[model samples]
Target: MKKELLVLVSLFLSFSSFTQSRESEVDRLNSIIQDETVHDTTVVNTYLELADQFYLKNPDTAIYICEKALSLAQEINFLKGQSEAHDWLGYLKKDKGHYDAAVFHFKRSLSIQKTLDDKLSISNTYTNFASVYTKKGKLDSSLFYHQKALFLRQSVGDLNLEANSLNNIGSTYHTKGNLPEALRYYIQSLKIAEKLGDKSSIATGKYNIGFMYNQQGDTAKALSYFLDAKEINEEIGNQSALASNLIHIGHIYSKSKNYSKAVKYTRQALCINNDIGNAYGRANTMYNLGFLYKDQGDLDSAYVYIKKSLGLLQQFGIKNGVAACFIGLGQIDYEKNNLVQAQNYGEKALTLAREISKPEKIRAASELLYQVYEKQGQGLKALEMHKLFVEMRDSLMDIESQKSIIEQNMEYEFEKKEALKQVEHEKEIAISNAEKKQQQLIMWGSVFGLILVTAFVIVLISRLKTTRKQKRLIQKKNKENELLLGEIHHRVKNNLQVISSLLSLQEKDITDEVAKKAIMEGKDRVNSIGLIHKLLYQDDQFSGIKMQEYTQKLIESLSNTFGFEKGEISTNIAMGDTWLDIDTAIPIGLIINELSVNSLKYAFDKERENELEIALTEKNKQLYLSFKDNGTGKKDDLFASDSFGYRLVQSLTRQLNGKLEIDDNDGLHYHLLFKSYKRIKS
Candidate 1:
């Protein structure tokens, strides 16, 4: 229903950047730094601690403070202090989008920590490295480092750090489009943070939960939690969060058609991002604004904002965002009737989306490209793009359907498969990086040829892999479903039987003969439908009703209901084994119920030997049915009545599109002919 490409808080996958007030800690660390006599490792550690205190609110100042610690530690040979400084600097740099530098510092921190044999320090460095990888869009690498930190933190019994790692891992999974896994990790992280009374972490969890809800199409619930989280973010001075919250809120408002409020909230978020120098946040917020403008039919505004967002995203090299912006630009151009520009933008978007291995974006780009191509008289290209679009759309649908089916039928059935997805994530970063580089070099030349080859090959491999991996899953599920389906049929039949019993119980109190007879007939009609279900679940072959046994049972049931003696009426059936699908069997059952009830109630008398006969057979590819009873024939027309049974017989005859004939000569007789019905497999 919704995606986090624009709405969700970036911190859902990021560490909680906000913390409780550190003024007192900052003051104490400053006091230790100013002590001229205390020039030991304590002094170096003091500088590192102070740098950590300032990092969030003042990143540049924090980096400046950490550099002094790094220098002093090198001079004094304080290895621990140097590692801590490097870790803090890496974190500070990562927050500011200085990814390459962040990695450099993080690697140095890990190197020193290896020598120091400090598990906590090493894990902390690992966490920083994970964040750097996350920002660089290397989700596989991000998850590996996050898992490493998580394990170490768990071993150290640091619930706080463990919560952070869990949240980071969830964030990585979220980026990979694995919401179930993401929610699993987020819940665990939230439980620990709530236990630790960490409001910052709580706020992070709140928004992530909201994002999950947003994806679920629960906009009101998502908005409620987002607003509550925003209040907490405000309380904790979470700067990035302020902007992130408004962007989410704005998107919701835009969905509600509250354009003015959406615009206000988004512009406010953009201003916040600009103030904080968060290029990523700014780029995304602008993208949201552009899309928002586009939705409102402010095409010019959409083009302007989207164009700007495209530039910033290009600068950051976020392929996902880049592809989305291209789609937006393409849409705007298509609206402007610039088919050529639209095609150009769609091609770029499709290439980048394919390069990034994002199916949703690929689908969007393919659709837009096909429309543009068709308009430009490129029928073959349009057809090809349309075919790809369908494959992507269908593949996504198949995966989603299978996932839902598996989840609903058997909880935890997919748990083991989750581990399979966790592998190759480390290579994900490397592969993505290499693809982006290669694509950039060859994009303007032979891009379509390259993309066509890459897309179809990848498409085939992915479908094959998905099918192979889930074949057993689906087969097992189908087996389970068959059992479940049988049980459902059994319960339905039982429920109908209960209703029939209730009618009989109610009929016992009725003193009127006519009303009692009507009640008897109503009960019998219910029984007719129930009998089909009864036959269905009683046997393994459930596709059709076995008419030979089923008709005998129906006659036996009616005879018992009417208190007729077993030998009082002689019955004959001409049909042998005829199996009709449930759809044809049901109405036929009801028709038989009405006709048999009428003969038992009105056509028969105790003075004469009763005789009944029913014939059903197929000839000339047509079904023929006959029923007759030896009794006094009524002078009145049988079907000329306002009774439900009379109308029901006529309606059912019309429903099957059959012709029916009745004769009142000597004894009542009915003949029916129908087009051949669907034959269920026996």
Candidate 2:
């Protein structure tokens, strides 16, 4: 069950990945190919990339796959895809050493790229052509193409590719025997690679440096650099690079006459090439191994190895490797005393080497043929081969070439010393400029700091003057406001007294007792609010009035209005320093006034002692008020009265945030428990 579940999970994950890849690759490709707005063309390019991975490892299968991609691209009228396929085909052909076929493909790719106006791709195609030309021993053509690619790459500002182009130009110069020029370009390329931190490019640069030194006969330095490059390639696991490094190292060993070590290195390179299916690399390594065997005097082993190498070379169409292999086989036959076979092999080597226009190969083949023809008793043929051998050898080692090399080396060294001196001079100038800049910065900073401090002091002094002026204005405005409030309050109190005087006069002219009583009640209500304003205007705190003093004043006014002597009403006041703002106090005063007047008039009798008890206190944040009379107690129906005073008292009590209850058993009693309005004390 667990195994089945694991299988199901794996299938689910794989299906999901496949769906996503299909969406991104195939579906996106369809959109790009159909839509002119889209510039990206990855699907066909990706197929070519996939082919590249397998092509070296399994050429037959990868070629078929790549060809299928090309066909599909052509069929679909995908120009970019066709262009990419052509470039990839060119690379594969170049790697296999089919120069003519490679050139044909690169030319096609370049034409397509130019038609598409793809500058970068056009530059890459140029590079590919250069690589093929370099392998074909056409130094002038290789250098021309490399320079063209470099220009285009630089125009596009691709620094990484610019470095690659520089390296390729350096390689071309090296092949042309311009070691100093090659080293300069190599150093330039190396600096860019170092800046980019491209390890692969750095390794290639080191290898090129080593190869240049090897050409200069600096074996120790060459070996050190080669080993350094080899270490990096090994660490990076670049199998192709590792194979190349091994082959170069093997060449160095062979030159030093260390045949065993040479054979070992060549064999290792051969193994790498075989594993990676690099036919050209394998062929070259095999030929080197055969040469090592020849150096060790192992004729049979040399013949066998060279024979295998010649076959691979023929299969790959590598003329250089094939020519070298033929020479090796010829030398082995000559050393074994097989003159006729040696002559045959030597003749084939010369023909092929001349056809390829490789002067070095031609010289070697001519030298070998000279000995073979002499041994075979062909006198005329021997002399002709000898003359050709001397001619080719002298041309290859001409005086001008030697002088040119020496002059370039001397120039390079002189420039190196000049560059060092220039760098030191620039360093001293940089220090002087930095010091001057630092002093200028210090001087400017001090000036800016002084300006800031002066500005702050000016602003502080101005702010202090403005603040003092504002303080005086605020104080004057406050005094005026206080005096204005006091005058207004005094006018309001005078207006209430005038209204009370008019009511008294109106009451004297009246005949109805009830109307007279109503006027007196109205006058007393007006006076109650007036007294509150009197206390307000007396102080600067326009906040609240003293409720105890306010109540005492209200009762005294009521006693005078009713013509009751102080002894006519026994008043017991229990209010503390309770202060009430005008809003709550006005309603409270009215209710107290109405109740006190009612008690003094109706709830009291001449025949009995009457007492008006009023108390206001706070408990648990609630205000309580008790007003009672030792005369007559009324019914509990507060809304039952049509009398204005009775209704006013009930309405005012309801206005407060408390309820009213009448208890007639002890006396006419009013008890209120206010849960909302708070009692404030001052």
Candidate 3:
């Protein structure tokens, strides 16, 4: 037997005459839809309204009517009507177990509501989407949408909707078995509901908390909360909530083995459900009473109640409830030793449970069937049923395991955050202690001024001697480190020079001018990197290369290599003194070498009126390098043909994570921007 305390509370608020009022309202909307004189928008709205009212009662009819409304709204070009229709369609489709279709409609409504800039509609649609996703067993997606709805509702200052969003999120956590998170959200919702003085919402919050406590096996706490919710619901004349609370309290009594109290409360709940015409609630209570009677050894009474429940649930088209009723009947038959009849009932329950995708019911039914088959000496059949039962049980355990891992992660994050807050609090305490120590020092200094002066002089001399010794030691260590780094860089530069010399020797034996020129270019590239280490060896810092000085020296050396006179190819360097670490310096030097070599070879005329400009600067933590040549503009084959130098520049730019911009407005201009890697002392 099970109590059907809903995981998520009802969206609509309860009232004394809610059902009667809803019936009358539905009739009125239907009358409007029938009238030909009404505007298309009005007719569409009436249809949507009627469909919402019938959503729980007759979902298929609701879907049909909502479709009509949607069609008419589109014909009339009424965007608001269309959005409302889509949202209602989502609600109806979700109730009918069309989860994917329901999600589609919800998203469609959200898209339209966003275009209209209707905050309330957008928030409502988000909440509905979350509800559908939750029903589809997607807990993370459901929570995300609920959070979105909460943010939007809070921004619009709609405390009522915001509370509903919080409660819905709590339901998602509850389904995932994260009771602590569920309780937190529920309590937050309760606070908001109390602030807004929303009686129905307050009762919903209380009922959900009671249900959570019930699941936790705390009957005393659960019963107390259930009683509180019942009192409030009764005073407000909300029979639906009152009945739900009564039934749950009955469940608590049943768990504690108080059969008499359980029957009493459940029967009272049943009568109230009947009075309110709550077929679903009444059927659920009847099923619970059947199980109670069966446990008390009254098989005949159990059969009557279970049969009635099956009929009622069947009429309501609730397949899961029907499957549960069949399981109860099968158990009763098995108890009576009617093995054949028991097996038939068990198989029927299993089929319906599987059809409805109710794993718990399927497992229960399979277990009963397994017993019956074993009694009949059908070993293979019994084994098959046992396997099904075990498989379903294991599946449930796997789901629980996943949820436990998620809960552990959440707990770790929460503890980490709390630890950080505790550290901050400790820091404040430390500051307070420091202030007290300073006051104590001031008082002591006044009382022993003369003696303290003599002692202070002695301490000052000792401290001065110690500080000087430390300074001299640090200076000696720093000097040793600088000398070691300088020797390393000097050796590296010498090795590069040896390689360049070998390349020059190889160039002399080459007969082809093109091959010899290529060798010279390769030697030039090696020299550019060697120049950076040479500068590091010369400077005292040995931490970074000075770019301005390196650039001037590079231009002078390149001029001599290319046999370019002063007037023939003028090189102007305009930049402030900037220091870069070796990592950044090597790449910049190579890029400069390639561009300068390319310009000297192809970007000049016989008139000797060529100019090249190089500038470097740092701004906003970014380094900008600009290179321009007032010679011929870029030729068609300059970057189009994938030459080694052109590709190398592109590759090096990417390695630096920098941008390369080429503007051919005046001449060929290259602008590169990258993060400046400045040298920092260890």
Candidate 4:
């Protein structure tokens, strides 16, 4: 928005020269409009031309002409002409300092442009509205509008307009006492203009920078930049800009007390202003001349120049210049000791200063009024004037203080915003870091868990392999033990068969009962050992013996051996499923052999159908074996004697880790109890 205002101000300044002839130009254009029998579009164009010519000098006339043009365009539905007329109307109103009206017209123009899709004109309207706000001192609003203009222009690749906006914003900052901010924007503008080869814009930015530096009291730096700007303007043949730069440099020299150099520059500026017919510039140059002469103590020359400057300023409606001239005249009168005239002049200056809101001029006039009253010997009046002087001085000081405070607040707010942005950025970085760490931990955790599972699988596989190996070893040892037992059994069986054959032959030759009985007994012992081998070889698993099966087979084989199958003796076997290791199996087998032989020999004494029973049971890791029979009762004294069969039974029972018992009545019963052997696989 400020940018647009600057452009407007530049345009106003540029066209200021036309103000002298503007009425005549408008009149001539009006004559042309009246004489032409043109179409609506041509008529509108003529009216717009006349409007533009009269805009600065006769805004009301310009407005009238623009409205006529607008009506014609609207009647014909000539959008382009309508848009142009609205823009001109806005410009006319803005030049007349009717900012609100100007804004309304500019907005209307902007809407039309948008409807027409005229991007360039839309930007222009935005800039125009921004300029109106800036002139009205609505700086923030102006800035907003200018930014809009800048953005649109930049989007359209209008470098010149973008730079102009930058410079305008800088100028606003300058007015707001943001020197550093202003300098930054100015430098940015300068860089863009330089890159675009826009010498005029570059020169303008340089001149602004120099002026800002001058205002900041950096005269040496300001002078350097001004010289650069002057050089560029001269090279580009921009006489008006060159003259302005020269005038500013001259003022700086004047302030530095370089009167001779000041005079030289001021004279050159004056010549340019006169050639260009710029009333305002001419007045400014004249005022500078007055100051130069006044500083040099040439009162006569100062008076003449100051009066001329005052006349020009009044004619141009330059209020600040008029106040300054009045103050100068007051100073001259006070110096001359013309107290009444001095007081009058000072009051006049004070009135003008207040009207224009020029505080420095007010302060100057107040001080001069106090001096004038002091010289006139009016002590009370002088004291009052002194008080007024002090009040004005203090008020100016307060204004400066307020301006400083405002500047500080703005700076602090800016810094605070920047700090907050930095903190937010850091927080984002921290969050990002934390997320990255969490992801890494999850990744590593998953990897470690997989490793642990893989290791457990490996251990389980190893354990299974070891178990299989141990089982194979045990099986092999069991097989070898089985083979050894089988061999013993085969040898025992062979010896038993030979003994039986010898007995048969001896029975044929000797025909003796005692010899036959001895042979048969020997044969029975050998057969008992052979029967153990038969049970051992019956099953593939040789870890332990099946006691019930072994006992049953032994009893049946013994019945066949004693030739009891056709005799009147019957044997019954009862047992539970019980198994023992080979260590216990051999002893138990021998014990069973003795019991069975005795039962067959003595149990059926009368041969009237006798019964024999054998039983084996195991519980709680203990084994029991029993034999019973029904026969003619044997005398206790006869069984009590140590017979070979009885001795064999006792020895075998002792070997089996068992105790034996016997009962005699109508039958005999024998029992043996033993600790069962627990098998441990290799």
> Which candidate ranks first by TM-score, i.e. highest?
2
Which residue runs does candidate 4 get wrong by more than 4 Å? 1-75, 89-157, 256-260, 298-322, 337-682
Q: Which residue pairs in candidate 4 collide? A: 1-142, 1-145, 1-146, 5-131
Sort by lDDT, best first: 3, 1, 2, 4
- What lDDT does candidate 3 reach at residue 124? 88
**Candidate 2 accuracy as lDDT:** 0.75
Per-residue lDDT of candidate 2, residues 362-425 (tens digit): 8889999999988888899999999999877655544444345434433543453354345446
Better of 3 and 4 by lDDT: 3
Candidate ranking under TM-score, highest first, comes to 2, 1, 3, 4
Please write out the lDDT profile of model 1 over residues 316-391, one tens digit for every residue: 5677888999999998999999998999999999998776667678999999999998888999999999999987
lDDT of 3 by residue, 1-682 (tens): 0011111112222322346677567556656666768888888877776666655545665687788888888888999999999998887777556778888998899889999999999988888888776655566888998999999999999999989999999988876656667877899899999999998899999889989878755678888888988988988999888988888988888887899999999999998987765667888889999988998899999999999999887775567688789889989999999898899889988988776455667889999999999999999999999999988765443433333433443354345335434544654565566556556655555556567887656655655565566556556655665566677667767876876785676566555576566667777877887788788788765657788899888887887788877667777897666877766787888898888888777776647578889998887888888999887766455768677788888888888888888877667889999864564342
Per-model tally of clashing residue pairs: 1, 0, 0, 4
Error of 3 at 46 (Å): 5.3
Residue 268 accuracy (lDDT) in model 1: 92
Q: What clash pairs does model 3 have?
A: none
Better of 2 and 3 by TM-score: 2
Candidates 2 and 3: which is better by lDDT? 3
Please report, in order, the local distance difference test score of every candidate based on alpha carbons. Answer: 0.76, 0.75, 0.77, 0.71
Worst 10 residues of 2 by lDDT: 1-10
